[model samples]
Target chain A: MDLVLLLQRIFDALFNSAIYSSLALALVIIFRSTGLLNFAQGEMATFTAYIAFVLLAGPQPRLTGGGLAGLIPGVPFSIPLAIFGAVLCGMAAGAMTERALIRPLGGASDVALVNITIGLLLATNSLMAQWWGTGPRFFPAIFPTGAGQHFTILGARLRYSTVGVWVILLSALILLVLLLRHTKTGLAFRAVSISPSNAELVGVRVGPTLMYGWAMASGFGALAACLSANSVLLEPNMMLRVLVYAFAAATLGGLDSPKGALLGGLIIGLSQTLIPAYVPFIGFELSVLPALVAMVVILLIRPAGLFGTQRIERI
Target chain B: MSAQAPRRFTPVSVAGLIVLAGLLVAIPFLTTTTSLRQATQIVVSVLAVLGVNIATGYGGMISLGHGVFVGVGAFATGYYVGDLQLPWLLAIALGAITAGLAGALVGVPALRIRGIHLALVTLGLAIVFRPLSKRFPSITGGVSGRSIDARFDAPGWWPSDGRMASSVYRYVFCVLIVVLVLWATWNLVNSRFGRSMRALRDNHMAAAIYGIDLVAARVTTFAISAGIAGLCGALQVLLVPFVSQDKYPAQESLVIYASAVIGGLGTIWGSVLGVLARTVLGKAGSALAGYDGLGPLGEFFDLLDESAFVFGVGLIILTFLFPRGLAGLGRKNQVPK
Candidate 1:
């Protein structure tokens, strides 16, 4: 392949990595805080994206141009306000799910917990299908999506939208770092994740911290969903495939490590892009194969993952 | 007067059994061939659900990739019959064995991983099955998949048209196989081996301390479970007599697990109930969607077209209300909690 083409592929991979990392971070946080593998994370985010879409642009635009918009006639349509509202809703949904589903079934076996999440997955996806209609809806872009919105960088054309995605992700990461390291609530959340019993004895509110973890994870998921919907149009089953990719990324990076999730996402994304280009045998249809293969191999070699702390079992 | 006799069957029970037998016999004649096809699907699902019950319900292993085994069985049948021009029965056997062997391969890893990790590994297999099948075009017939030309028509003794005869023959064939398999499974579950398997599921360290070979029990359970799934796949192709990559997807595994749970896991009769519940619920969804009587709520009714919503609600309610499942209802000495 030509140098320009390769560089462009690298750029595309970076954009994909940003989105995948966002989803992977969401998965990692939940696993770390709750000790539960939430299978519904992606679907919940997809539901949130649909909510944002409906707020900003829908057949029946309740906030923008019709329904509720008439009640407040002075304010103009704002995508930013729509996204903010959607994220807040996402946080509430996360808190509600933790309270309603997880709390009620407390002390249940792992199988039961997993099944409940699976149930949530099915419920969320199908509910979205019913409300949004299964057909792909045109989600208005938050960044410029036109072909003209690009510039040559070292003989390689780079889309401004891709740059926008990176900027959003980078900002989210910085904010997360600040929140977890410098804030009192973030310390409580971290303490709970490390040792819930200790945190509780130390006067940290364990239940609310866990809920905040879910809320933060879901908020990131909603942002990732909006990024993806901008590129791939809105559909109910869109997250199904993406969820698998995120799983591979999270597992590859180590389930409990945030930095590892980002690294794993980038590695998987780049390999997915580069493999079909270089290797003629594995075609585009099997683009996901490399990431999965990488995951399995990494897991077999080191079950704790590349950056994950080794879980020392004591008999 | 002091000697008590064993009550073999209550009159109501005997009468119910007779009624059930009569209905089974009359179904092929009374219902249209389309309905027979539905019955065939139910039997196949029962087999798959039973497979899941053996591993997850009886053996305490979580797998979300059983669909791959079924897919393998279907593809194997398609390859043998379509590509090799083999007999239908042999093809089915080969197909089932292929799935069983694949199951054993997966079981090797199950030895190390437990709980969520095992679930992840199995799910990975399901995700990989599709692309792998697509990659091997000569074996799997690529994206479009393979179709079988071998037909098992009715014998000369049966007096019926070709279509009806074929449907009845398929139904009878499925029923016979299901009965035999059910009997075998019942025996397996009740035997001394079944006790060891149950011990293993209930407690690993305790089972190991009691002279149970952990590896042997786990492998055997997986093989048997996978073999049953394979059989279901083979039977499935014979019903429609077509196999494709699209026939079995990863999400189908979730439905199979749900069916096993909904049927009341580990119980023999629950498998049938689970399939019946699934088929009945599906038909109800379509019916509910078709109804146009509700004025403003008609829009609400239209949402029933989304089968996953109904299934999700049903699963959550069933899990909360009766963790043991529909089969746990109205049994002697039954204790749910």
Candidate 2:
């Protein structure tokens, strides 16, 4: 039991925990408003990350490839500006997806919803591959990540990027709380999430409210992708593995609970880092197995999760 | 209850059958051995799509991880044939059965997890499979994948001994197996057990009231569906003697599911139609992609070359325009809840 190594691992795990927490929060928002899980969330986020990449890299056809690259502005933007632009683009896309694709279905079957999302996943993934080659692209870190750019405490070095990510995550989370609690739109959103029919009866536009929810969720997802892109490397399939971890976190915290998503993210992220370190066979690549197994076990024993409301079905 | 009327083949259907049969017969002569093998591989993929149809459309379980069973089937068949020194036919059968047993294992979890959650779990399984299989290098050939030592070849009774002959032999075998399985599945879905399976899918409580063993029906439906997919995988090895993890990506599973949906679910012919649609669309996309005169539009055309993109867009369009799928286009829009 090397205490220093363990502490170091925990510090490393916190960065991922923040990533998973934000992504899980994104999942929770959508699931809370609509019963359908957005399987395309990761891909959508990845697309935004690409948008940021294009923004930062400017109109270099050689770098960004053909197609939409021709549409990007000629001047390169700073990293924060590029990320900001990407998040905005992501929010708009999310809202449009909800309005165009999902709303038209008008409360379709589970299978139909699954088909639509999966369709989006496949299309967006290939589209990214087409625009930006399947090869990994370098994304600049939002925070300084040079050697010695870390804090030492208790004989363990904590990277500045980890603290910087948490700061961003926590501030965004606080903003989310404020918006949800203080704003009228947030109240309407809460009402819609609780009961769409009732909210409609009370004069709230359930459709637009749900669209806002989707936008907000997508914004969170975009942020997660942008923040983690430096660490994970930007690619079409970058978020596929991260999506699993976030889903596990969401499920663990209770699929429909926001606070649970954050907590679940913390726990799943730590386990992801620690389990692989301790378990000889799991290694780094197969660490996803534990998160998956945990998800199955949680689904089996506790369908509602720690914080989610228990669903009552009438026969 | 009064006896139901037997379904009669319409003139249109008879014409369709004739055209399909003619195309199947002409394929070997029209193409080289390589193209013939590719055509056979496309035909074999129908079984995988059909597996999804059974589990999702007929059995009422949305299994997005049928590709896992297919991978298991291929790997297991490779092991049984190459390592165990068994005959190809016996190994193929055992391979399918092995996949069926694995499906039964997944089906156990599915008993409690229904609808979208089941879909989530299956998708997770699909993602996990490649990494999981990599751990077993001996059986799965680790990361890069292993090649089988033995080849499935034609016997000397009535055929010329050549590479083309062996290719033709494998193609015929695959087509025969696919048709046989399709016929068997059609019968099974219309049988008493099949009724129970559908009954459970429609309403498990009502099904249980009608004396259907919910557990047995659900598990068996998944098992049979997975077995069919496994058979597809076994035939894949027969066509190309390579078993690799790269072949079974999460996207592959989604594509298979998309095929099932696009072809239409709950109908045997829908499975075949789905695969046909995929083949036709892929060829058309690639041909269009190759044309340089389209200018800026060529970029969009290039996207067509990627089957995942085509299927993804197709799935969305079909979901909106023809919820019942291509097979259900002219039929009444009576999509079951």
Candidate 3:
């Protein structure tokens, strides 16, 4: 009701969207490489987030008020180091999934792979719930002690969590774009995307290249998971909307286009934030409405996705 | 119809099915209460799995939203029986019919599109459908859910002997519903309509080119699948006297797909067998994890996680190793793919 408070909430929403966009980018990366929808994508992110949670719970070095060690005296390792562990965990899970689960089912139908991923999702979720007991674990935020916490810009209070999310997302996006554009691995990845058989014939290690693609996607997914985990309580259901929103974003942007995921994510995040705020009929209950509407619109107008090449199936 | 041609009425298959029906009829007399309880669980699981079989197995359509159909059926049964005060049998029929019609409607967009797009839509359906069910508390019974007790009564010929009589009637109802489904599905698969359904699955383009009528065939199949799923929901409500949306979540659709795969797609017996395996494995895992008998064996075990992890790993392995499922595996051993 208060204009200042409302703007602050909107700012917070935008800040949090960076994580969703980043995850959307990860999904886009995998789709670009393998053309698989990767149903287990969000769950894979959850696995890593849980890893980060466990790592965060480790013993911490003693610190004075100004000392770096003062934050949550339990975690033995540096926050960055724990993040590294989580990233590795995410990448490894992604690789194992690609090599063990996906590769073996090669030449099978698309539905089979999707179904397998769906199964993977349930399996992973159950395993985690059994281990973690379905309770939310406190995740340590990476922002500086007083960073982005209740800073008023244009009379709106903004949290450092929001700002940190945006910064990480932008940095990751830039890194990803650069990697895809100029790097040798990126070139090979793009080649695989365009034509896997042709790329393999042209001396690209197509299999490993695809695996790397999954690793990269999952790695970014982990970052998104960690960032979002800071803001929201990380539960088994934490990543539920990640996949849906990401899929919609990726689809709207162009299923196979990384840039599309970013645009799609931002657009979705903004709409999701803005719609419920401004629109009268669509209340909080319809949280998923914006993403769903955007998706239907994109699919109807551009079935191949916003930025995807038109697919033509001939007899 | 002569014995020499396809039209021949040998009734071998039908005769075998009837005998199986008779065996199912005898199940209440043979099994313990514990076993009957387990069997009841299997029946419920199979109801949802039947929808998955219809949507995923036979149709070559992987729907992660069949849970919604089950939920819809359950809620409808709850409303019909719990509120409208309808007969048990009519409630079940109506519930299934309602879900079937809903499934047909959901299939409209899918009738035009193909692949991942269709899947995303269905996934969205599963996600949204749950909330929608929750919102309509008056019909759905909301969070608390509604209990259903009106089952086929004890026959006039048999005297009510307390616990034994009650359990027997419930078991009979469960078995009767299952056998009826199997028999109906058998006739469905062998019928021209069934063949067309298979054809549509086998080669959608070829079938369409040959005049299979894409809209009618696909939509009808989707409806039938949803209807079967609804029938399962109603049966479960009848058996357990409980119907809740939480019982059928978006994830349940995934579980059903896994069941369909393990059971083998495109076969009636496979669907039944798949449901049995799923129920047994899932139940055994949950039950035996804390079992005292496994004191010595317990050191080597954790059974519950097996279902959770194994479901996904199993699907991945089966798709790789035996794409045709258990039925296909059986057939392969008998002859060859």
Candidate 4:
């Protein structure tokens, strides 16, 4: 491959990985602590992005007064504020879902719990369609837009959005790492994940910690949604295919490890971008196949994933 | 007293069975052609649900890609009978066998990953099925899909003619196949292998320690279920006379799972009940959506147009209310709950 083409693919992969890692990280948070894969993670993220859109949407330059858009009066819809609000809203939604639905079904079998999440997925996606109608809506760009917003690196020009995505992803990672490692709540979360009964015995307040874990994970999911909406616009079904990719990434990384999620997401993102660019037969139409097939192959060889601890099955 | 007790059948139960059989046979005469076709579709759904029951309910393997098996079966039949001009009967059997082989391929991963993980793997299979179907233009007819001109017409002895004849022909075959499969499933569940399969589902480690070959049983169960699902697909194309990529989206897989769960997971009768409930409720939901009498309530009812909402709520409510599913309603010894 030419160096320019190779460099462009690398940059594209990095940009894509930023979004995938955010989602995979979110999935890992829930799986590590709750022992259940949040199948609705992507839908939850998209729902939060809709909240972001509602907040960011304002009267056009030609229009004067606003009704729902001017809820704060004279603020004229701030993108940063909307992003912040969406993240908080996502956290609240995640916490509410955990407390209201998942917690109540704690006694149900794993299969039942999984099915409930699937139900949640279907309900949430359709709710979006019913509420907003089933069409792609204009989502405002959070990054700067200009013709001169490109920099040549290794003979390939990178857009400002690419850099912006990386910045957001890195900040989210740092914030999560610091929170999990330093905070008392984080300690309690770790304690509960290791052993809920033991953590409860130690007065760690297991339920709240789990709720916190979900909240944090969902906040990351909202961020991922914002990053994704930057390119794809907003639609109810936008995240469905992305969710499959995230699942593949999570499986490849190790469902129980945050770092693994990040690394796995990068690997998957790179392969998905590069394979379609290079391979003659499989084009963009079958782009999703390689990553998923790779994940399955990895799983068959090492079921626990690259960085996950092997589960010891007791007799 | 010296001889063994004679086989006993209560008069009421015997009467109930006769009435049920009468109703089953009378469906074609009683309902319109469209309704008869819908009934055939429901039977096809029941067959698919039964496939789910064998693997998930009986074998303890959670599959989210049962629809893919059905799609494969449909595509197989479409290619064999439509393209190759093979006999429809032979095409259906081959389609089912092809689907069974695909199921076994999917089951190979189950040997490594299971539970929700297995579910995720199956779900990936479902997601991949759409694009994969598009890739093979010759077999699946690419994005446009393929259509069959050969109609399933009633035999010479039947009374109906024209479209009704085809409807009656397909309906008769569906009923026969449903009954045959149901009986075979009943026997399977009562047999030694059935007991072993149930044991494996309940506790795989214990079953394995008890001398059961876990891999063989699990893979075989998946194969059988896939075969049944494939048959449903073949019957569906036979009834509808067309097969397209749009016909079997990934979402349909979830709907199939919902049907199996709604029907009562492991029980054969539950599979039938679940399909019946889904078809009836689905039609009722659409009817409720079109009902325009209640002013603002009409708008509220219109949301029922999104069947996912109804089925999602149904799945949750049923999981909570009747863990054993709707068919478990009258049984005093319902398991799980």
lDDT at A130, model 2: 86
Chain B TM-score for the candidates in order:
0.90, 0.97, 0.84, 0.91
Residue-level lDDT of model 1, residues B189-303, one tens digit each, is 7787877878887777898999999999999889889988998998888888777887666667777777777877767766777877887787888788888887878767676
Interface RMSD of 1: 2.3
What docking tier does model 4 reach? medium
Q: Write the per-residue lDDT of candidate 2 for residues A1-315, one digit (tens) a residue.
A: 999999999999999999999999998999999898999999999999998888888767686443365575654788999899899999999999999999999989898999999999999999999878899999999999999999999999999999999998899889988999999999999999999999999999999999999999999999999999999999999999899899999999999999999999999999999999999999998999999989998999998999999988888
Worst 10 residues of 1 chain A by lDDT: A61-70
The parts of candidate 4 lying over 4 Å away from their true place are A58-76, A145-148, B1-23, B332-337
**Model 2 C-alpha lDDT per residue in residues B50-75, reported as the tens digit of each score:** 99999998988998899999999999
Cα-based TM-score, every candidate: 0.91, 0.97, 0.88, 0.93
DockQ of predicted model 4: 0.59
- TM-score leaderboard ranking: 2, 4, 1, 3
Q: For model 3, state the Cα shift of residue B304 in Å.
A: 3.3
Query: Pick by DockQ: which candidate is best?
Result: 2
**Which residue pairs show backbone clashes in model 1?**
none
Q: Positional deviation of A140 in candidate 1, in angstroms? A: 3.4
Chain A TM-scores of all predicted models: 0.92, 0.97, 0.87, 0.93
Candidate 3: tens digits of C-alpha lDDT, residues B259-306: 877777766666776776776677777677767686667733463645
Give each model's whole-structure lDDT: 0.79, 0.91, 0.74, 0.82
